[model samples]
Structures are given as structure tokens and as C-alpha cells.
Target: MSNHTALSTQLQHTGIIDAAKAQQLQTAASPWWLQILLGIAAWIASVLIIGSFLGPLLALADNNPVRTVAAVALLAAAIWLTTRKQEFLQQMAVAIALAGQGLLVYVIYDVSGSNDETARYACAVIAILLLLSPLNQLHQRASLSIALLCLLSLVSSAPLLAVVSSLLAIVAALLWCSRLKWAGFAQAATIKSLLEVITLAALALTLFGQCLLWLDTGYWLDNRLDMARALYSALGSVLLISTVFWLSRLATVPSRLALLTIAVVLCILLYPASGLLVSTALMLACFYGCSRNWYALCLLSMLLAISQFYYSLELNLLHKSGILALSGVTLLAAWLLLQRYQRRLV
Candidate 1:
């Protein structure tokens, strides 16, 4: 057969050049400008409807109806936009969901009897939104979950709301685990999903710690140091486990560096003071492992050092003799490690 005939046959076998269906799919997908206009129209309609109808009705019931109505309206508009523009839905959904979350936080602050209650409800809403929105459909699951969690937290007593929020968190965790199991870690999408899950979990834990602090300042002070240490340890363990799994699947140097960067950041955030030592050591090790690449380690190390320095200054340790001695030793060790790696690379 001629080259042209052979190429045509191969294209048909691979299903890349479908002359009939490609044109139809392209036509069916809405243009970018049209999608934008539709989203704007939906947002306007939601605002008007909620402001004119829902706001007044809620106000009559002695609620801060204006803010509530606005939050609901924005959330509705986001759902509508997601439905009409599924192609670009992920990016748009995050923005709209965040706006909705902001509105909810404002409403919680304005309506709550105490700042502690407001904070608890705000954290709960944020955790639920982060857990639900990215994995499931915006309209079906995320909107429903947000609405339910908001009502439970804002309208219920503190004790009951805390229970409800904790339950919801457990549910979200289970669902996240199931998704991870089904979509194996080898997939790129799975990596993104796992990162989101870890972020939400970390935020939830921090908020839980804040709640403990708010309930009893004395108790918080007595236990916070230990709690911080434990939290950082847990975070470190998670990073080590995830790194092993990721390294097996990822062979490329850049991908490994990316994973290491994420692990380093998590360590810093989870335990800024103590994490400084670990993160510094990890970065140096990463640099050595990656063949003494200065460019790769520079940014990660600088971020960890800055955060550690800020935390140290905050704790009034800058003038302490012991801290200064420790800092000097740490720097010397890091420099030595760098030199050793540099020589090996040469």
C-alpha cells in the first residue's frame, strides 16, 4: 500500500482522526465568550432573586437576612455556572466557592453571640467546602454539603454544632480515602486529589487546635506546646510515607523535586520552630540526592529559614545564648553538607 493509505489506516486504528464526530463535539462545546456571558447573567439573576425575595423573608424571621441571602445567591450562581460550563468548571468553581465561603464567614461573624462560636463555624464551613467541592459535582454534592454544614454550625448550639461538624469531617475523610484507593497513586489526577485532601486535613487540625485554645486559654497554654510537637510529628510521618509512594511511581528528577518541595512546605507549616531543623536537613539531603543542584534547594531552604527566623523572633529567642549557638551549629552543618555534595558532583 502507498504511504498515504497506510497512514490513514493507522489513524483509524488509533481513533485520533474521526472525521464525523470531531466536528460535532467541537460545535457542541460552547465558546469561551458565550460561557462567560451566561455565567454573568446567572450571577445577576441570583443576586436579584435572593435580595428581593429571600432577604426580606429571612429578615422578617429576625435573622441577618441580607448577608445570608447574598451568600446563598452567590453560591447558587456558582452552581449554575458550573453546570453550563463544565469544561472550565474546576477553575471557576474554586473561585466561586471561595466567595461563597467568605460570605458565610462574614455572616457567622456578624450573627454569632461570641467570637469563639463564629470561629468554630467558619472553620467547619471551610473544611467542608474544601473536602467536598473538588471531588464531587459542584451542584449536586458541594452546594448541598455547604448548605447543610452552614445551617448545622450557625443555627445549632456550640456543643451540638461541634459534634455535627466532627461527624461531617469523618465522612469527608472516608470518601477521600475511597477515592484514593479507587484512583491509584500512579495517576496524576490522584496526586492532585491527595494534595488537596492533605491540605484540608491540615487546616481542619489547626482549626481544631484553635477551638481548644478558645475554650480555655489556660488549658491551651498548658498543652499547646505538646500538641504542636505531636502535630508536627504526625505531619512528618505522613510526608515520609507519601514520598516513598510517590518516588516509586515518579522516576523523573523534576517530579521528585516537586514532591520533595511539597513535603518540605508541609513540614514547615506543621511545625515552624522545630520543623526548621528537619526541613533544613531535608533540603540539604534533597540537594545532595539530586546531585547538588543549588537552584532547586535555594528556594525551599530560604522559605524554611525565613519562617523559622520569624517564629524564633516572635518567641523572644533571638537574644538567647542557646538559640544563637544552635543556629550557628545548624548553619555550619548545612554548609558542610553542601560542600561535600558539591565535591562529589565535581
Candidate 2:
């Protein structure tokens, strides 16, 4: 949402589309179960096999000199091997990097509490490693995902700092995507890759973390975990406003009266979905898609957002129906108004 206005206003001023051309999509891959099998194996090893087991086995020693040195050396070796290989060992590189990050995290958790007593400082160091990933392969993307996971892991413990850093990272990603001029080396792949990681992290947290409980329960709201949801919603509301203005007024009457009417209807959406982290994620994804002219993303985001609303346990059927009706009508009116504006311009 921070970057949405900049791009949207630019698009309106210039009759150009820095967008992907339309083409039918197709996919071909090996058995889905096999792919899942490999992924599960890799993830388990990263989180348990080498990550937890070997990390603790080494930490049993009284000192970290050997363990730290070995971790660094292994990471260096993995990067070297990954870059040197002619064949893309994407899985191998990703697994090794994950293992390294987990080991560093473990060291920070175990030793930092006793020494400097600043575990967060070690977390920051690990974050830097993920950001400065040495492998010039797809492993870089995996590093971004791990980095996002690290951020999410810190959210409940350090709500303000983690949310601020995640916001800054998303802003940086948008700026990078904007710089990828047509036919650039990586095009928008880097931007998309970065966003994908962030999106998945947000989804995971909202779906499985304290976010669900926060949304589904209102008995207690004084915890730090709830702080994360509030912060996210506050930021996401900016995009919601921007989008409402763009669709209903900017391209229409552009008058105070028109703006007032639109805001009144948009209020319906605010109360029902504002506090939920998943709702924020959906809207942010929608705004991101609209800003970047990613049609497929927009459609997918819309469906996900709708489904989330339909499946919400926080609101009863009657309230859900009201919210859905209001949302649907608001969008319908905005769409009709936008179509009219387009016709007038034509």
C-alpha cells in the first residue's frame, strides 16, 4: 500500500502498461507426491535431522568455538559447491543454507542468553546472513523465505520492531521491482520472488500463529501477539483507503460529495475485516497486484480474500452475510463507476 499510490498515479498519468502480456498458462511437472516427498525430506532435515539433532549434538560441548567455525565453514562450502555446479542443485543448496541458519539460531538462543544476554542481536546477525546469501542461484530466493520466517518468528516477542522491519522489507522489494525496466536481466522475477516469500510467511503466521486466536477471540486483547495484528491492520487500512478512492472517486466525480459517499460505503468493509491478520494479508496482496498490473495475482487474491471471509469463525452467519453483501455491493459500485469513467475517457 505504501507504494501503491505512486504506481497507480503514474499509470493514470501515462497511458502505458508496464505489465506482463497476456498468455495462456501451462504447467508440467513430475508426480506431485514425489515433489512433496522431496520437499518434506528437505524441510524435516532443515528443522530436525541436521538442524536440531546435529546442532544440539555439537552444542553439548562446553564451548562454541568448534561449532561456530564448523557452521561457518559448511555454509561457505555449500555456497561454493552450489555456484560451481553446472547442474542446478537448488534443493541441496537450500537445504544446506537452512541448516546453517538453524545452527546459528540455535547458538544465539543457547549462548547469547548467558553471555551478552542479547539474543535478538544474534537473531539480527542471522537475518543479515540470509539477506547476504552468497549463492547466486535459486537458493537466494530460499534465503529470502527463511529471512521472512525469521521476521515472523520475532513478531510476537518484538512486535513493534518486527512489524517495522517487515514493512521496510516490503517497501524495499516494491522499489526494486519498480527499477526492473522491461527485459531486464531478471525482469520482475526478483520482486515476485521476494513478495512470494513475504506472502507465504504472512499466510503461515496468520493461519497457524496467535493471529487466528486473536481474531477468533475477543476476551483478551492486551498481549503483544495482538499488537502484531493491530499494526498490520493499521498499515493495510491505508491501502484499503487508497483503493477505494482510486476506484470510486479519482476516476469518477473527483468531488467532495463523491468522496463522502464512497467512504460511507467503504466503512462497511473496515469494521468486519480490519482486525484480522489474514484479511490484511488478502487486501495487501490485492493492492500489490493492482499496483503492479498483475492480473492473475489480483484474481487469485480476490478469491482468497473472499474465501477467507466465508470461512471466518469470528463472525456468525448473519454478520458474515452483512459483511459479504456490503463488500460485494461496494465493489460492484466501484466497478460500474470505473467502467463509466473509462467509457467517458474513450
Candidate 3:
């Protein structure tokens, strides 16, 4: 056969049409690409229209009834757009929601008359939007991460509150992630991917704060909030106890004992980072007790723990060395105990 005929046969077998048909196919594809371009243009157009509506409000130079109306109108339109089933509209809705949220925050920033409160209120607004919108929607749930970040931003002044917010985000993330165990929930691939990424990102963020220089963990630490320490410690002890109790079944007694000893050492490490260490350990223990799917959580926990311990300025080299030595001995003992118990009991 001629080269052209041979190529044609091969192409036909591969389910591709001849060059003549390729022209036709390309012509057909042009409209789809055009549609995509048009959709993008539409999204931009919607944003511009909303910006026009917000223009006068911005000139108001401050938050007032007019700005408030614009903000609410944009939000309501964004929400209304989300209910539209058309693909183009959905994309437009995402843009509108984001822009609307920004406008709302701007108004709030102006009304509050303080840039300091912006993070907290922005987080509050996003949280409200998340709860109001469909949890299964990727965009709505995904944006919640901004709020999680606002909480992390609080670490500079309110370390305890920051930790509390982190804890809350983790708990909420896990509760949502737990649904992934079932076939029905697992079918929503986009939702699952978004949730896992957001949750892990948030977890990493929570750990990131510990890398900072904390006043409570330094020699010249703030003694004013020693009461904060007392409260955190009390809660930490309860967490430790419950954590041990939960691990009682899965872990050998020696393993649990090792873990308990480590918890005690961490609590008295005279480092606020230790609070997170205990909390992370407890969270990991909970994950392991509840699901074998906790490998990611465990890995993240270990990584964050190592970072916190390593960067801990208050933990001198000698103290860090001692902690590591005890950890090794405890682990070795636990391994031996587990082996003996397994051989004897099982």
C-alpha cells in the first residue's frame, strides 16, 4: 500500500478520521473552545457589573446604609447564581461570591475603623458563608481555609486562642472527613479531594505557628498569662487521660505507658509548644483508634512535632537530648513488651 493509504488505515483503526475529517472535527471543536472563552468572559463581565454597583458605595468613603445594601445585594446575587444549574453560571457564581465576600469585608473594615479587626471579621464572614452554602460544594467549603488562616494569624498575640481555633478546625475537618469512609460519600471525588487538601493544609498551618518564637516558651516569657498555662495544662491532662484510655485497646500496655510518660514530659517541658505536642499526639491517637485511614494525619503529626521540638528555643540542647533519649528507651521498652505480650497472649 502507499504510505498515505497505510497511514489512513492505521488512523482509522486508532479511531481517528482521515485528514479531510480532521478539518471537520477541528471546526466542530472551535465552538466548544469558544464557549469556554465566552464563559470566562461572562464571569468577568458579572464581576465588573458588581464592581460598578459597588463603585458608588466605595465613594461613600465609609461603611453606611448604601454600602451595606450593595454588599448584601452582591451576596444575595452570588447565592442566587449558585442555585443556577448551568455550567457557565456556576463559574460566574464562584467569581461573584468571592468578589462579594471581598466587598463585604471592605465595608466591614471601613465600619470597624480598624485594620486590626479585619482578619477576625473576615473569618467570621467566610465561616457564615461556608455554613450557609452547600458543604458538598468545593468552592464554598474550600474558601473556609481563609478563615482557618485568620485563626492562625492570631498566634502573635493570642496564642491560646490560636491553638483553640486550630483544634476546632481539625475537629471539624475530621468530622467531615469521616464521612469519606462510606461508598456514598466517597463518590463525590471533587469534594473528597478538596476536603483532604484543605484539612491537611490547615493542619500544616497549625503547626507552622509553633515554629515562631513564643513568649511563653522563652526565658523572658510573659508571666501574666501563667494562668493560661494552668488552664491549658488542666485541659491537657484530661486530654492525655482520655487519649490513654482510648489507646488502651489498640496499643499494648507498654505502648500506652510509653505514650503516657512522654505526655507528662511534654507537659512540663516549660514550653508552650508542648501544648500542641500533646494535642497533636492526642489527635493522632484518636485517628488511629477510629480509622486506619489516619496515615496522613500521623505523618503530618510527626513532622509538625519534630519541627516544634527542633525550633523550640526554650528547650536547650541538653534538655532536647534528654527528651530524645527517654523517647528512644521508652519506644524500645514498648517494642519488647509488645513482643512478649503478643507471644504470650495471642
Candidate 4:
């Protein structure tokens, strides 16, 4: 506190900043609870405002054309509001955008006769549009991304889910890996925000895929689920191998080979529980790209992966235990060898 005051005083004395600006800078921020309360109030107000006109419009909601037009109008309003300089307007915009998106999706589902595939495609299109739209608010983008994930998961086929999960994984890998290269670009912050959203969606999708194992639908469904799991495992292994290969480019030739060997071994051992591979690859990518403040996220992902891997049904308890134990031992040995190699290099 004293240092900050001294620095402020120095800046003020040096005429770098005026007294009013320095005083403003030194003002304390709002309390967390106050901020939360404000957000809740804004949401309630927005909801009520939307409800005011929606009551009469409810009759026309059944008409696909009317609902579509209304949704587009609301989305357009949201986009405009988001560009305003007011915080309250931005908060309201999120609510309006969500309502608009929900209505649009409802229309899609209604038009498709409740077909999951059609709804999923509609969600993909909406998500893409949201990404391209001028709505760069993190909260808005994250909410829509989550909504897309949830809607896609609802009644979606296992094969479709697996494919979406793979695509998200690939996108996350590419974004995180190349984040630093684009750091100086005008849209770097936007890219980073998108990366965060994609990473979260990827993690959630991986969870959904892993949890599908416990769903005991009919025999035919079981066969389809097995195929999806196998497909994910193949893709995840390739992704993990590619990630390790990318990371190894900075190492010596022998170290690169060692790292690739370790990655391949991990993929083979954890092949049955492919969620582990996906989560591990994501964690490593996050740590490599943005380790400064992402340690907690990486740790959370690893913990989730470990817990999921433990309960996974692809292997029996004894087999799973053996694989885990062997993996730990192998990793320990590799770390020790790497330490020795580093000493030799030094």
C-alpha cells in the first residue's frame, strides 16, 4: 500500500498524471457481493422488460416466421446495445441475446419436428454466427458457447458427439499453440477469449463423452456407444501424440525422441479411458501456452481426468489400477532421466 501510494505521489509530482486522475486511480473497486447484486438486478430487470412485450407475442410464438423475425430483431438490438459505453446496457444485452438465441433454437427444433441432428446443426450455425458477430463480450460469448454445448449434448447421437468433441479438441490445440504468435495482433485479446471458451467447451464435451459409458441404453445403442468411444480414443491418441511432437521441437534430438516415446506410451496405456488422453493433452497445451495464470485450470482439468479415468468402465478395476501404477512409475523414471540429462547439458 505504501509503495503504491509513493508511486502515485511520484507520478503526481512529476506531472505524469493530474491529481484528479491519480485520486481516481487510487479509489477502491466495488465489493464482489455488490457487483454480484448489481448483475442480478440487471438480469431481473432485463427479464421483466422482455416479458412485458413477450406476453402478447406469445400467441405468435407458435408461428415460425414471427418467432424468427422477433429473434433476429432482439439479436440485432443486443448487438447494438453491446456497442454502447454503458455497463448496464451491456448486461442487458446479454439477457436479450440469450432470450433471442433460445427462441431461435426453439423455432429450429419446432421446424425440425424435434430432430436432434437438425437442432445440433442449428446450434453450430448460431455459435458460428455469434463468433463472427460484433458481440465481443466474454460473458456473452461464453454463455452462448455453453448453451451450444448443452443443446448439442441433449439427445445427440454418440457418433455426432464424438465428432464434435474431436473438432473442438483440434481447434483448442491450434488456438492455444499459436496464441503467442498472434499476441501482438489487433484481435489478440479476442483470439485469447475464444481460446478460453473453446478450451472450456472441449473439456465439457470430453466429460460428456466419458459419461456416456455409464448410459445403459439398449444393445444396439451399446454397440454404437462402443464405436464412438473407440473413435474418440483413436482421435485423442493422435492429438496427444501430435501435441507432444509439437512440444518436443524445442528439445534436443534425443530429448525429442524421449518425449515422443513417453507420449506414445501414455496414449497406449490410457487408450481405454480416452478422456484421460484428451484432458491431459488440453492441460499440457494450456500450460505450455499460458502457464502464467492458467495453473489452476490445468490442475482442475488433471484432477477431473484422473477421477474420470478411475471410474471408466473400459477396463476392470484391477487392470485400471495396474495401468495407473505402471504409468506413474514410468513417468517418475522419465523425470529422473530428464534431470540427469539436464545436468549433463549444464
Candidate 5:
């Protein structure tokens, strides 16, 4: 063949191969329904195996070799099914669901006098792995659902494990949601889902701490207080980290407003009087810096008003000091709004 003809033929073959590969890639990515079905199947298999083995092992440790063997067999089958899928959605959903159910089973067994540290550690590791899996929207949603279920299960069976798992799940969900490149309702839905996880986790931790306190004993009280303090510290750290991340995601005005609101609430909930004053000052500074936006100025004014009212009712602050702070915030807000209106008219 002529050299020119040979080069042309080679190029044609390369193009054909590339086209075929592209088609194959598209085909490999299955529909969301199929992925969801596969995930459900894997979850069912995992539950059957883990539940059979764990329940028998916990309740009848000596006489249930059959249940234990069956559980192992089922888990192996589920793992095999999960490994067969290379698609992001299928693999992630199946793996996360399986891992979540497995963790639930392990917690049940551990709390039932088995007291297996190894099992608990394994569950934690698996849960983390599931959270870290590469998945599309369907898989991420499945993973979030599974994680929430696991959180609820652990709450009743193992409070400490529940807290750790829930926190990790919340962080993972938020990270995953932030990476999603969706628009409109889809994006809003993902953010709402993540916020729900956070809210649930916070409520769970609070309830768990309160329950411990109600159990009654000096030792229990001391431990409960320590746990509450630890929880508050952890929440403060999360809020700080979240604020920093969100500042990058949010508009300037909304970012400042959110940070100010969060700081005020955190100070009231977690800090003493001195910390409250410091946080209030910080919020005032943030508001002042971002007062160009009317919405931000309005939010700041409302916050200041509430804070002043609460402070007056709760503390014997000098009347002049209270008056000065309130007056400053009011004047600043009025000036900002007037400037904004004038600019808009111009």
C-alpha cells in the first residue's frame, strides 16, 4: 500500500475504535432504576446473612453454627454481586447499602453481650468506606439513606457508635453534595438532604446526653456533662469549618450573615458570658463590614435587637451600654438601607 493510503487507513481504524469505546462507556452506565434495584437486592442479602448469624451468635452462642455459616454465605453473595458492577452508581449504592446493614447487624450483636471490639471497629471501617465510594446522584442518595438508617439503629443500640457514624455520615453527605454539579431543584434537594442529616444527628446527640443524665448518679452526671461539653466543642468546630467552606460557596452578603447568625447561636449555646460578648462583638464587626446589602443589614438589625432584649432581661447590664449598642446597630442599618435605595434609584 502507498504510505499515504496506509496512514489514512490507520487513522480511520483509530476513529472507529474510539467511537466504539464511547458507545461502550455509555452502555455500561445503566439507568437509575436498575441501580436502585441492585442496591435493594444487596441490602436484603446482607440483612439476611448478618441478621441470621449475629442474632444466633448473640442469643445462642454455642448452638447456632448453622446460622453463622448461613450469614457468612449470604454476605459473600452480596459482596460478589457488588463487585460484579463497575458502573459508579450500581457499585456505590450496593456497597453502601450492604455496609450499612452490616454495621447495623454488628451493633446489635455487640450490644447483646457479645462485646466484640473487633466487630465494632470493622463496622466503622466499612461505613467509612461506603461513604467514600464514588457514586452518582442515585448512589449518593442511597448511601445517605443507608447512613441515616444506620444512625438510627446505632442510637438505640450503641449511642457512642451512633454518634461517630452519624457525624461521619453528615460530613460525607455534605462533601458529596457540595461536589454535585446540578442546578435548581436538584441542587436545593441535595442541600436540604444534607441539612436534614445534620439536624437529626444533633438531635440524637442531645437526646442521648439528656437520657444519660436522667439515668441518675454522680458518676453518670459527670460523664454526661463531659459528653455534652465534648459534643458542644465538636459542634463549634463543625460550624467553623462549615462556615469557611460555605463562604466559598455563598455570596458575600449571605456568607457574612450566615456566619454572624451561627456565631451568635453558638456563643449562646456553648459559651459563658465573656465568650458571648466576644462572639457578639465579632458578629457586629462582620455585620458592619457587610452592611452594603440591605438583606444583610436587616438580618443584623434583627439579631442585634433580639440579643439586646435577651441581655436586658437576663443580665443587669448598664442601661447606657445597652442603649448604645442597640442605637449603633439601628443607625447603621438605617444608613445602609438609605444608601442602597438611593443607589437603586440612581
Candidate 6:
């Protein structure tokens, strides 16, 4: 802590940071709970402000095209407001933008004759645009990406969506794990935010896939979905292999092969349990990536995976218990192997 303070002081002395900026940096920010409360208060204020004018706006518009135009204008204004330096304006901008998005979706639905598919596609495009543009802040990007994945699930078949999401997770995990390699680049901050958004979306889609399987959704297990399920599982295995190889990139060939071998073994053991395989890969990604902020998410994913294993319909309780025991033993062995390698290096 003293080192950090000294460094900051030196940086300020060197004129790398202005005095005001340095002071701002040195000051402790509000607690997380207080920040949340402030944000909620800001949102409530924005909502009430919007609501007060919304009725009159609707009365004046009264038609889909006019409402769509109004919604677009509102979104544009909200985006512009976000670029302002004031914290309150930024908070209000997020709420206003969300409200604009809801209004836009409603208008789209009405314009397209209540076509759900069209609305989903439109919203997905908007989400992708927001993710790609600098107009959105970090939290907005994360929320928009999650919304994008949800839109995808609505438009595509469950099995195919599962495969797409697994592949997305792998790519996102690799990007996140390699973040330090390109940290010196000018685009690093943008890339970091983008990867964070993608990582969140991947986690969300993984959980969505798990829920479908856990609920035994009729659409997920229909006769026509057999081939799709097979494809999903096959692609999932490949993705798991790729994730393991990437996470072990710094290791020797023998070590990489050993990790891959363990991953493949787990893949085979967890074949009937699709979500657990992907969740494990994601958890490994978080762990090896040293993503401290995402540690809670990784823990949650693992807990859900374990619960999914316990409730899997493919295996009876005795078989599930045995497989889980074996899984625990396998993980322990892997941990020991890794420790041995670490000790050798030390």
C-alpha cells in the first residue's frame, strides 16, 4: 500500500497525472453497497422523470412510426448524455437508454405485426451495435451482451444455440486469458471491456443451456433434436479440448498433453451431462486467467454444475454419486500433479 502511494506521488510529481486527478485517485471511493444504493436512487429518479413525460409523449405520437422515431431520438440523446462528465447524468443516461430500448422493442413488435422473431432479431442487432460502439459504458455493454444471447436463444434452436454459446465461451475465455499479452497496446482498454462483456454473455448462455437440460424441456429433447444434441455435444468436446490447450499454453508439451488428457477424460465421463462440461471449462478459464472479479461467478458455475450432475435424468442416484466421487478424485489428482510441477520449478 505504501509502495502504491509512493508510486502515485511520483507519477503526480512527474506531471503524468494532474494534482486534482491524483487527489481524486488517492481518495477512497464509496463502498460497493453505497454505490449500488446511489445507482438505484438515480434510476428511480430517472424512471419517474421519464414516466411523467411518457404519457404525454404517447398521447402525441399515438402511432408506431412516430413512437419508433421518438424512441430512436431518446436513445441518441441518452448515448450523448453518457459522454458527459457528470456522474448523475451518466446514471440517468443508463436508465433512459434502457427505457428507450424497451420502447424501441415495443414499437418494433407493433410495426412487425407482433412478430416475435422480427423483434428478437432487431433487438439482437441493437445489442451487437451497442457492444461494438463506444457509446455504451462497461455495465451497459455487459447487460447488452447478455440480452444478445437471450435474443439468440429465442431465434435459434436450443441445441444449436448451445453449441454456438460453448464456442463463444471458448473464444472469450482465450481472449481473457491472454489479455496481459497485449496490455501495452493502445486498444487494450477497449479490448478488455469487450472481452469482459463476451465472458459475461458466455456465462449467461452456459447457464441458460443448463436450465434447458435441467428442466427437461420438450423442445430440447424432441425426436428432431437428436442430431442437434449430438452435434452440440461433439462441438462441446472440441471446445473443451481447445480451452484446455490454450489455458496450458505456457506449459511444456508433456504438461499440456497431460492436462488435455484429463480434460478429454472428463469430457467422456460428463458426456451425458452437457452443461457441466462447458461450465468446467469456463471455471478453468477463470481460474487460470486469474480473473479475481469473476471468482464468485466461477464458484457459482461450479456449484450449479455439481447440482446439475446430481439431478441428471440420464443416470440414477447411485450412478451419479459414483461419477461425482470419481470426478472429485480426478480433480484432486490433477491438483497434486500441478503442485508437483510447481515444486520442481521452485
User: How do all models score by TM-score?
Assistant: 0.39, 0.60, 0.57, 0.78, 0.38, 0.83
The TM-score obtained by model 3 is 0.57
Predicted structure with the largest lDDT when compared to the true one? 4
Query: What's model 5's overall lDDT?
Result: 0.45
Better of 4 and 6 by TM-score: 6
- Taking all chains together, the TM-score of candidate 4 against the true structure is 0.78
lDDT tens digits, residue span 279-318, model 5: 2332333343342342243344335444444454444557
Quote model 5's TM-score: 0.38
**How many clashing residue pairs are found in candidate 2?**
0
Q: What is the lDDT of residue 46 in candidate 5?
A: 45
Q: lDDT of all the models against the reference?
A: 0.47, 0.52, 0.57, 0.77, 0.45, 0.71
List, residue by residue over 95-161, the lDDT tens digit for candidate 2. 7665666666666667766543245556556645655555643666666665554544454443563
Off by over 4 Å in 4: 1-34, 56-69, 107-120, 139-147, 150-160, 217-222, 291-295, 312-314
- Using TM-score as the yardstick, the better of models 3 and 6 is 6
lDDT of 3 by residue, 1-346 (tens): 6555666667766875656644433342336777688668867888688777777667866446666677677767777887876656766776776676666676677667758567476756665555456433545554666565665554543346444634544453444535546424534554454455554653554454444345334432234344444444454445555555555657766656765765565455524553454445445553643544554564556566666676667668787777666656655775676677678766
Error of 1 at 53 (Å): 2.8
Residue range 9-66, candidate 4, lDDT tens digits = 7899999788986886676666888767877887898899888856678775658898
**Candidate 6 — what's its lDDT?**
0.71
Off by over 4 Å in 2: 1-63, 85-88, 113-124, 157-192, 202-234, 243-264, 275-316
The best-first sequence of candidates by TM-score reads 6, 4, 2, 3, 1, 5
lDDT of 1 by residue, 188-292 (tens): 353434433433333343344323422454522344444544544444334443533344353345444444554454443434343333333333333433424
Off by over 4 Å in 5: 1-68, 83-113, 116-119, 125-223, 226-346
Q: What is the lDDT of residue 181 in candidate 1?
A: 55
